[model samples]
Target: MIGIATFLYIYGYKYICKAILTAKVMFMNNLNAPFPLLQSNKVKFISSFSFGFFVFVFLYIFQPFGINEVQFYKPLFIGGYALITFSCVAFSFFGLPLLFKNTFNPDKWTVKKAALYTSFIILIISVGNWYYTATIGQEVISLKHSFLKFIGITFSVGIFPTVIFLIFTEKTLRKVNESKAGNITKQIHTDLEIEEEKQENDIIPQIDFLADNNSIPLNQLNFLCIKSEGNYLEVFFFIDGKLNKSVIRYPLKKAFEQVNELNNIHHCHRSFIANFDQIEKVSGNARNYELHLRNLTFTIPVSRGFSKDLIAIYK
Candidate 1:
């Protein structure tokens, strides 16, 4: 019986430890997920104001914390709490972003950082709420005690609904985008088959290629591809059957504008203009499309916005 009890106790302890670890990991993951960036100060202010308004309305309706017991000046009392919430939200959304730029960045954002930063905001808000009520409202409560209470209030009212909405909206948007991309991908592939037979490059006349205001006779060289590197453009072409690369001090748009009027020369991506005749292959999933030009090792991307135009070029 003693041995059995010991084993049971050990088993229970291990299970609890494992459960705790799993919860911790899940919490971390939730913190790091991608979240939408609050783009402008105007948006931040509006969001804060909206949240404060919500809290005020909810408090007035629900009358929690015995606000109903107060006969006169009840709205005034609740309004003060609303102002606290607004102030806290404003401080968090406006001020914290500048401090946690990378964490709140749309591209690099993760659930983990958002959660941590949100908790930080909640902490500040909880403190503010507690301090306000204790000092002004004259509620006698410890900061530590008020913190948890305020956090619970904020979470129940704001965070929970926002989280649910974000999750549902994100899933729906992803599904729709993926489906749309898939259709576009299929259509692009069909177009690619027809495009294979088109010989649009034949009519292209040799034009001088510009590099730092210096022009090289493009007719002398077999053009392959042109891609952008920030302020400069990299020109890929063949000279005497040997592949050569030249750096031109020009943006992709400017460089391509000069060449796009020519047959088969097209802007495929934000950073790339490709010669269709030189394209060896095109392949990618719905999210992205890549063009493989002849005599080139790397692939060039095709933007979704330009996908229809690219397909139209073949027709």
Candidate 2:
């Protein structure tokens, strides 16, 4: 009978662990929405209460401790037992996990931390059992022996469930990461398709660039940088992962007129035109400003007049 009672107690909490942990995984994998209760700490307390209620009801029905044992179904005794056990389990679940919040992160999980957490849980359950037994007039013959028994019983209750929770948490996290990666890959493909469609429909009017004997293809993604050289302009662009430069004999105004059709490119100064999307950094005050563009060795000056427009664009 004692063996059956011990088996049932440990087995009951193991079932509870699976129920609550499975619910947690389902909440995480839910595509539409998550349950509100699971979002808050109340779920922990509620889960504990439910498991306590189930165990108490099972014990009530079976009376497994034997007919010689004291009545457990009496209103006062049962209510007090329910209060103590539920509060202990609820506090253990609701509070202890949070105490190691920084350590509990799955990415950096350590065996040392997990062992410590397990030990703490066992201690809590053991103390809770000791308190319950004391309240029921169970006299301590030897304090150390009673403590050892409580530790052993609580260990049996805690170990298997802890293992289940950790395993489920690891598996759930892996599936979530895989799902995220798949979604990200699909999104990237969609974005590329949209941009390709836009390029096909869009057209650039030909501006005779006489600098390096090359015409600027406004549709291309990688146009490096442009600079003013005396009255002529230097148009530096990229092709096939290589840098190409052309000196346009025309003034900056003519180049701006041609490049203005592209939204990502901006005319920032009388001597400079920049692809705003490629800019790495912007520096300087009202008197003098500079735009540092990515993948380019040089920086472009930002004229005082264009500063307000740049600010407005960002805002």
Candidate 2 has a TM-score of 0.39
Model 2 agreement with the true structure over 184-285: per-residue lDDT tens digits: 334545655666678777763333333345656643366655788897788877668777777767778767777766556777877788877555555552
Among all windows of ten consecutive residues in candidate 1, which has the lowest summed lDDT? 138-147
The global Cα lDDT (0 to 1) of model 2 is 0.58
lDDT of 2 at 47: 52
- lDDT tens digits, residues 1-315, model 1? 999999999999999999999999998777654454445576568767877888799889997765666666678878887898789878888777788776565545565665666677667767777677668665432223356787777676667535653564455545544555455556656755676556355343688876586885564228888888888888888888888888878777778777765566878777888887666655644234567677798988877656566556544
RMSD of 2: 21.0
Q: Which ranges of candidate 2 are over 4 A from the true structure? A: 1-43, 50-68, 72-85, 97-101, 104-107, 137-145, 160-164, 167-179, 195-315
Candidate 1 Cα lDDT to native: 0.69
Candidate 1 TM-score, true structure as reference: 0.48
